[model samples]
Target: MLHGGSLPHLTPEETLAPILSALESVLGSARPVALHQPHFAGREWDYVKDCLDTGWVSSVGAYVTRLETALQDYTGVAHALAVVNGTAALHVCCLLAGVIAGDEVLLPTLTFVATANAVSYCGATPHLVDVSPVTLGVDAIRLAAYLEDIAELRGDTCYNRTTGHPLRALIVMHTFGHPAELDALAELCRRYRIVLIEDAAEALGSFYRDQHVGQWGLLSAVSFNGNKIVTTGGGGAVLTNDAALAQRARHLTTTAKQPHPWAFVHDQVAYNYRLPNLNAALGCAQLEQLPDFVSRKRALAQRYQHAFAAVAAGHIVNEPQDTRSNYWLNVLQLHPAYGHLRDALLETCQARGILVRPAWELMHRLPMYRDCPRMDMSTAEHLERHLVCLPSSVDTGSVDTGSEHA
Candidate 1:
């Protein structure tokens, strides 16, 4: 629908013209291109069928253990616990990081709401921070400066000068599978005496400086949602290098049941967040093909970069230096001068079945988090206005619409 036809009731601005043309060139004019979709070209059917045939579709099964082991190996984390969803994994991470009531957790304002919600679940305040334009994640330098000004380091704990709440942890979310500046952020956290946690929900195949993204944090969360590069039909995983933390995560996520074969012995109150065998069966198959999926996704991102190279209004957001990204969802960041055209572009693209979308609203802007402690949000606000996510499914057939670049 967005191929060569003119948009009705539109001013036909030069900026919008090239963007639409690029979308048409990459995604064709026949059908809608979803922003992100799961591709199950691996052994999903075989593994899932095996689970079905064996009647091990519940939480306790061989597939669940296999999936966890595979994740541990893939991410290079000593422990990987498969959970019900990404949010659940984050919640567990927050708990493990010792985020208690009245504590404050540093979070990127540009991330999804789930990151903030997870902290809230731990009874901690989500102290919002700004993100870097280069990585679209927490700006380590800016945050360091902000912390130097407002953070009080007494003993080994970091406290907010204004709120007087202990800064328990810093959650760095890898936006669109692009790894954040983990080394710098880790150094900053160490100086401030704050824990480092990673919201790696979108960074399954991403690596920072040859090291996987989740390895830098004390604990990290990864998602396998339907729209993610890897999907477990709504599942997630918690990764940690500490064996003690891993053991606690396993017990907590499994309802804290002490090992007893014949008796229903229960320990402390915990959650039933274990991943079902049905979901892990799918996850195992998906994990096996992660390398292929990341390759195809990177290829798709290259295509988008080439298609939009000549567009003066914006350019595709590339992976940061020294990082290998999965390019989970390719981003088109409009130039500051062309920021006003973002809405028009989104509306036009969606109307024409291109399925483009803007980034999520900043966490500080949301009503529930309006009163949360926050620093200057100028960077995130600008990014929110200029960012647009393009269709980035791994299936290249849907995007190979011919070389009709604008």
Candidate 2:
């Protein structure tokens, strides 16, 4: 069994061989193991069929409300408003957090582009920041230091000293379903008087210090995309503890219409971002199996961890201390010395029908965000180069945690 200690002396291809074998051992020689796939073994068909049979398949139906209530109960939030998709949910969260035009929102550069895009939707600039290797989310400590040096408080608003734009919100994304350090980040938000918004798109089942990930933020968003742990085919929700904010979220997402039997009266300019009842039905079913899905995925991660334990080239990225991750995507981060082999390893793994991928390109590197203001991206850059997302579908084979290796 090849191990990390021996990796430095081996060629790129040699180093990749053990990693590939480890993945194959755990996932079997299943010709096309997807990175992550939705598992619908619950009441999916039954509920969806109910929607179809009743001809109540659009946005305004019982299923939508049912799913919202389910999410609120599961996540322990006071309210959850279903929307068209995660992006829409995030946009609404931004709006609810008071992120207006010309404002600057702080978010990690390592997050999915949607996090940055949501800020842009509010006509706000995404001020990219680095992430912590521990959480694969925002580095709250570094951010506090950076903010202290570059931000100044004017009354209750935090403004970028250089750009002169108000720092209205800080988005903390739970990368790959691992909860970020919410307590620290929340404190930073308080000291700076900036609103905290959680991009919990991949963290539906994740928890931080016994509480759900979305609870720390004033307003947060959860995704139910086809690839997520809980799938609505295509849907999302805005979560909040404040009843007033929840009421406003519902109004804004539903096009800001005043309740009337026949009058078509809209009070403000809002979005038609309602999640269809059909999708909500599916979501309700998926939410029912979230616990099982999270369990299976976590077991799969443990298998990968043990399999790669002897592989000195790299190791699995586990949940940070005191946090419970959904393990939405199992990650294998190559040792810094072997970072150059990352592309080769990805190519080899894909060639063998074992699907794997690298992390998202840092947000600031994108063409549209090329000129966006950013802090040091050294950590994110390093993570982007070395992180490989392994097969993490709920149906993947699991191994006993007590075993030495898969």
Candidate 3:
């Protein structure tokens, strides 16, 4: 039959019908759909025009400060520094988190490459940790158990007993915009004197127990990529509540230059990673529409959940308890019995103009990270096989109408 082994007790066609119907229903039609794309129905035009007309389109301008101020006010963080991109923001956070050469940073195995690559940029090793089956993120209780088995705290520093590398920080990513268990994780990190950072790149409007996702950690990063809930074409920001940390982030992202007008006097080596004013202008416009986007996305998730509930082969992932997600991308977790049916469904959906994608391969399985220290990733492994990202882009009315409405 269809190349891969057929499902038991069902022919290829028999197994494909229900899934196909469910996919078509959730997509709202059979029209071509991107997994997630920017929705720009705001004052994007006027802002970009303002920047171009005034020639204040570089990294320095009023829009940069305006965007930073907007983010600070929205997230309730004390300071926000706009940056060139999410990866650059994460690198700066790693530097400010005190990550050094040969140090170890704890992270999840089932995450985007950017999450792990950021730790590597600091010359530190990424210690792969397992995630939870329910929340699909780092399990605070489980991580504590694993650390008890292998970690040793001495003189206010935590170290891997076997490898002798200092466990410097823990980077908790809000997987698929679902807020991680920050309360327990924060207390645990506090106990071991481990620095905490949040990779909130996928979670712009997500919240946990009434607090914003990025506010839990000492420092956090949010992305405004073309595909994120809100977009700035390509931009990111570092967030923090502490004034000292915020000042350091601002200084480091600006190439560490001395504050002298018309003087090129320099300080320490740093990065030219500030977000351009042109992009910040777009961000200011996008930020204004974020709440509306989040609302529409939540409604879409509900539709998917209801549609999938009637189909036996499908299950829609909803927000975790005591939390609110922006529903950046809706995940369709198939029944374990139908795991082998996914590739066929994915192929069929694409042939019918629907885009569906699976989760990223676990970091420990990658060739470069093959030798890194890690715990068992059974849950992440299962998720790697069965989860598919459905078309969760915010509703722009119909696929015919471009995502340009405000």
Candidate 4:
């Protein structure tokens, strides 16, 4: 018996066997291997079939409305606007937040590229700040320092000299389904008159205090991509408590047209960013299952944590405890003191057929973001080399047990 030891990291053979078994049992031996299979059943199928049958499979339909309604209920936000994807949702939020060209949007560098890309879409500069190693989210003290430095250098209350622009907004990304420092970020935004937009793409069921992730910001976004916890295959939504901002986002996403019968008059430039009814139907079904999915994912995470507790000493990583997370992707950060051993461990996991992946290269270090203003991301750089994402799925099936090192 392994006793307090974590279970062995998965081998490719081990990972494939269960998926193959499920497929053989459900779809027969004809199906090929798949990394992920949608777990839709019950009302999900009903929704998909009904959508096809009604010929309301395109962008506009009752299903879209239902998705919006369900999202509002699930997140407790006053309004929700479904969009084609998370990027579109963030773009629309930046537009509504008045993030114009030459303005700077403060954001953490340790997030998906899209989080920073959306700022570029509006022609605004992204000021990528370093993150706290503990939370893997933006550092509040560092942010304040950046703001103060800019204010002093520019002799302006709002503009930063390094970026050569006024910091117009703050885009807070909830990294890996864990809620960021929202309460502190919110207060900072308010004090600076900076618009706050939460990138809750990875944090659907995650919460800060008692409120859900999407409900914290003035404008917030969520993604339902194929790899996400609750996927609509490809869809996203923006949530807001401000009635006017919600109305404006909806208007802009649907082509910014004035209501005219057959007039086809467009008032301003807009985007073809509305979610298709078919996708929305899928979203609605997924939303219905989110609670169950969250519960199962958390349970799986607890198992991983228990396993890791044994091996995580000088070189293993573990989860944070300040806030509850949706556990979208279970991460293990190798101790930096492990040095070259981090790469060796990653190679070992892969050699054993486990699909462990490194943290995204710090966005500021990426070729596209190199020119963007960035504070020295010492912590992000340290974590980047060692953090690994395990093959986490709510449908772990018989492979429910796994080892993790803290």
Candidate 5:
């Protein structure tokens, strides 16, 4: 409701108190509430029990295969390989993308650290880019222009002439479950011959123009971490439509074992990043309840939107145009004038037993990535100052049927 303009604000306490009270009522407790947590309203126990009863709790089991099938079906991607975590999936994507030492992986600066860390794990430097104020994802227009101004086309590959490093791929994060401008970004990648990898870590059920977020890029990674829309405790998946890329991902993640009945033979130096069967069992159950979780989270987002309509200081972050978000983490970006109140609001909420968190510091600001090349990060700086992650756990089985039942 506080759209595109500043509002006349009272004191910070006066402004945030009502919002906290509203949250307390919705959450059904004055006790501390987590930002996000796993919800097991379906057959999670039964699936895990099956793994336990069959004694197939490790990497090898029916559950792992079933989980992959569920992901492939839900996401409409041809191939899905379950891995240990989202970071593992990203690292594998880097390897498969042909990113080598001294290569530069372009990504948005306003995302979680895992995206940059994954690029670092591949021995490539991260090239942080600006994000759109509205979408909170990379800005395609700016990215294309930046590439043109600083990059060169050396035959088939694009290289950042400024840094003298080949630009291997563009890693776009679907920030907070809202699908980015995939069509524009994909076209840019094509023009520059840059491989595209979608870090749909928070966007398991999100879509852009009816196409799932993870299905558009050359390869994508989805996280099943506890905070994501769907949780496998500690699991993730790599998704791609290309059979060759999918097969390569599977082989590389499973330690490149040359299939032999009992031979200890490995064809290449690979990572043991396979998701454990126990986690996959949990993932299978979570996938079954994903639709319901998505629905309930959207309902909560609607409630927050309506509430924010009455409050002038906060604007509820919603799905961007032509996109359907899972609303994984409900967000509010305070007006810049009131951005100074961010710390006060966070502390106030946490003291009142509601856990609210600010966005991560820009990757370029970090010491490890300080030297990485980047374009203007002004928009990301604005976001880092204003945005806040609110409580958005699945409310399927909440005890309090109050406003949270929205």
Candidate 6:
């Protein structure tokens, strides 16, 4: 895949036609340059074999503890709870955050729909806010403004003009592995009596102002999906400094049962969202290589940046400098002047055996969230129109674009 800004000169139609033609002609060259892929060096196989041999491939095992320990060390959280997936991690976080039915959770419209979906799963409404052009995370100032507006209107009888629910927490995402302006957002949440939760799913190794991203919020989540920097195939973790919250998450994630295996007494309608030992085995091995993966990913991003500069003028894109990103997905925004070129670029990349993608359609615009209240979605709309994501797999060596395409 090419750098964020560099593209070969071609009109939109010219770019798109090749892709459509190749869709029929180049049957084997349609692989996407994904932002991430699972990384293993036979270690995963060894772990899987070990799990099968030991007959402990389900929920309970040493690997589960090891995975959590590794994450606690990596993220600097006092405790971490392993769960079935990132969405489950977020659901557990919302429960621990005291988010009840009818409560409102503030979220950015630019994030993955799952962030909002998790809130809805708890029966809490999501108040979608616009993202900052710079960080692509929730804009702290805008969030503070929303809180003030809610307070000024006063009482449970009042409704936010932006969203009708009572704003209770702010869920800030470190989008595409870039850290958000979390410090300011944290202070705002504290002042507003709103809970702060970090969706650090895309930013496992990312730092903000020299500190890790997951530790800033009251509770945070990390995803180990097949597409993340590191993968457990499908797993996630919940982080917290509070002991009680960590314990609660652990109990809830393991099915919220009262201890006797034969009794099967459940105090709450708990979900079966535990991360199995087999997945934990993969997570354990992946955790061992995170530092290497992050370093290589960064180097790959740098190579793309430099190559794009030489490949074409005004074509290379780079992440802003204020926050250090894991470089999960290198993004480029087409010039608004070239706004019509976005669709063409995607097609061109596909034709050339590179998989490229446009930014997600705004969550608020999707069918499920169309009725949700959103405030000033101009930024989201602008991004949606111009943004594109190139292939960014950890397994693909930066200079080896041919191998990546293969």
Q: Which candidate number maximizes TM-score?
A: 2
Q: What is the C-alpha lDDT profile of model 1 across 1-406, one tens digit per residue?
A: 3222343443547669988888788876666667776777778889999999999999999999999999988888889999999999999999999999999999999999999999999889999999998999999999989998999999999999998999999999999999999999999999999999999999999999898889989999999989888899999999999999999999999999999897778789899999999999999998999998899889889989999887767889999999999999999998776788999999998888778899999999999999999999999999999999999888744534321112
Q: Total clashing residue pairs per candidate? A: 0, 4, 2, 4, 0, 7
Residue-level lDDT tens digits of model 3 in 1-406:
2223344577767877877787677676647778887877789999999999999999899999999999988888889999999999999999999999999999999899898999999999999999987778898888999999989999999999989999999999898899999999999999999999999999999999988888888999999998899899999999999899999999999999999989987799999999999999999999999888899889888878777776666588778899998888899887777788878888887888787788898999998888899998888989888898888788722554447632
Q: What is the TM-score of each candidate against the true structure?
A: 0.95, 0.96, 0.95, 0.86, 0.96, 0.88
Q: What ranges in model 4 sit over 4 Å off?
A: 1-37, 152-157, 313-322, 397-406
Error of 5 at 258 (Å): 0.4
What are the per-residue Cα lDDT tens digits for candidate 5 across 58-171? 988888999999998888999999999999999888889899889999999988899999999888999999999878999999998998899899999998898778999999
Model 1 residue 277 CA deviation (Å) reads 0.4
Q: Residue 262 of candidate 1: its Cα lDDT?
A: 77
Instruction: State how far residue 213 of model 5 sits from its true place (Å).
Output: 0.9
Worst lDDT run of 10 residues, candidate 3, spans: 1-10
Model 2, poorest ten-residue lDDT window? 397-406
**Model 4 lDDT tens row, 48-117:** 8898998999878998999999888888999999999999999999999889998888889899998999
Model 5 TM-score relative to the real fold: 0.96
10 residues in a row with least lDDT, candidate 5 = 397-406
Please write out the lDDT profile of model 6 over residues 211-250, one tens digit for every residue: 7888878899999898888888899999999999998888
What C-alpha lDDT values do all the predictions have? Answer: 0.90, 0.91, 0.88, 0.75, 0.87, 0.77
Q: Which ten-residue region of model 1 has the weakest summed lDDT?
A: 397-406
Q: What lDDT score is found at residue 341 in candidate 3? A: 80
